[model samples]
Target: MIFLLGLALLRGRVGDREAWHCGAVLIHPRYVLTAGHCVRDPNIPNLSLLGVRLGELNLTTNPDCQLGLCSSVVDVGVEQILVHPEYNRACLACHDLALVRLSRAIENLLPQIYPICLPLDPEGELGGSTDALHNSRDWGWIAGWGSVSGDPFNAQLPTVLQKAQVPLTPTPFCDALQQRYPDPSSTLCAGGEGPFTCKGDSGGPLMIDNRMRTRWYVLGITSKGPRVCGAPNTQTLFTNVHHHLSWILSNLRP
Candidate 1:
């Protein structure tokens, strides 16, 4: 997982920087995947891309950050921001994926700072023909340093990385909630009940366990949810990484 340390320049102040905003996932040694909105917006001015923080679990303090206790965290510089060509700020659900290229390739590839695998099959098959993600019983996890409360202005944001279990919403049910035509094939809906992802959780990965249950695969990217989060019967939508696999592969540096 990668935390986006967005440093937006203020309108008047030349060297002024704003706060860190969104989350992301490491998809390659130098490529990080996140929402297109996190990278650019036509309305917002003077906002510049800073970089990303890797192997980070806590944001507030490093109380027990040692060899065995915590993973070593490092902040890398951004070389480029690649938002999908079709990404539109007007449409929140369409083409929300983006990729960030680090200025330099990461040297330390530890368990905590490794890249997550993208889905190979359009149907979301994991190495085999079996569709592991088709069943609603197969649960996935979403992690981020987002605000615990629905209110964006809430000062009590979580310092430690938080995770929530979100079961895949059946396609029939998800399809019914489609607001636009041609219903985006590059999106997946989940979290009908229990804990749902909120603001600041955007661009985080929706991870599913592998067949052997040994490792997790990034199935989706956190996109949008109800205005009031965690509401019963409301499902959160994620940018389907499976559908965008080719786009991701094409953007990565060989």
Candidate 2:
């Protein structure tokens, strides 16, 4: 599960105790790709970021191991932040994407905290390629630490990692929603009923396995879903990472 958590807060107010809320990961060696809203409203002075505990699926345990099995770890702080230049809070379109630059490399601490590969062709829309994705059914994985239910606006961070299944809908079905939202060119849609992303799930991964190899690949970053959480027949929108590959590489590389 190559997942990252993110949030925004008045920068200086965060204490050492609030590690989980401040965490993010490097989508590139130098750049941190997270939800655009994560770093919104930079008017506050004290901005901070923390690194997640990799390989540790459960985050509920105490860091000191006093309560339960705790993992010995050192969380790193972010040095700089860069939300997408095009981000707009009003429409919630292309600006939903963001990036952060860390002070140092976290590779040694948790190698598994590596970047998920972007698709070879981002705009190659998944709808037309039914033959390739068909055998796998409409199933896909959505991982995050969002609230279990209720409170559509507020979200609960998971003590333990959480994951759910999301089914793929036809392009025609997605097009209808896209018309209403007019999302970024890099957007993708998934979900129907039963399984969907909630409030805290934003900026997480929607993973799908290769039909032939069964290898897991991240399809997109979990974005919005029906405005309110867990609405029936509502689909989640994600920024198609593949579509922004060049932009990401250029910005994050140097």
Q: Compare the candidates by lDDT and give the number of the best one.
A: 1
**Candidate 1 weakest lDDT stretch, 10 residues:** 5-14
RMSD of each: 4.6, 5.5
Assess every candidate by TM-score. 0.83, 0.71
Candidate 2: tens digits of C-alpha lDDT, residues 1-254:
33322211112234444434322334555555666655553443353444433334556453424234334443455667667666665464554666666566645433334555455542243333433452345777777666776466566656666677877653555666567554435577887677667766666776665545323555666656676666655677776666556666767644
Q: Where does model 2 exceed 4 Å of error?
A: 1-26, 41-56, 62-74, 109-112, 121-137, 153-156, 170-173, 180-184, 212-215
User: In model 1, where do residues sit more than 4 Å from their true spots?
Assistant: 1-17, 63-69, 89-92, 121-132, 152-155, 171-173
**How many steric clashes does model 2 contain?**
6
User: Best-fitting candidate, measured by TM-score?
Assistant: 1
Write down the worst ten-residue block by lDDT for model 2. Answer: 4-13
Each candidate's clash count: 0, 6
Backbone clash pairs in model 1 (N, Cα, C under 3 Å; residues 3+ apart or in different chains), count: 0
List of clashing residue pairs for candidate 2 = 11-46, 11-47, 12-46, 22-50, 87-95, 186-240
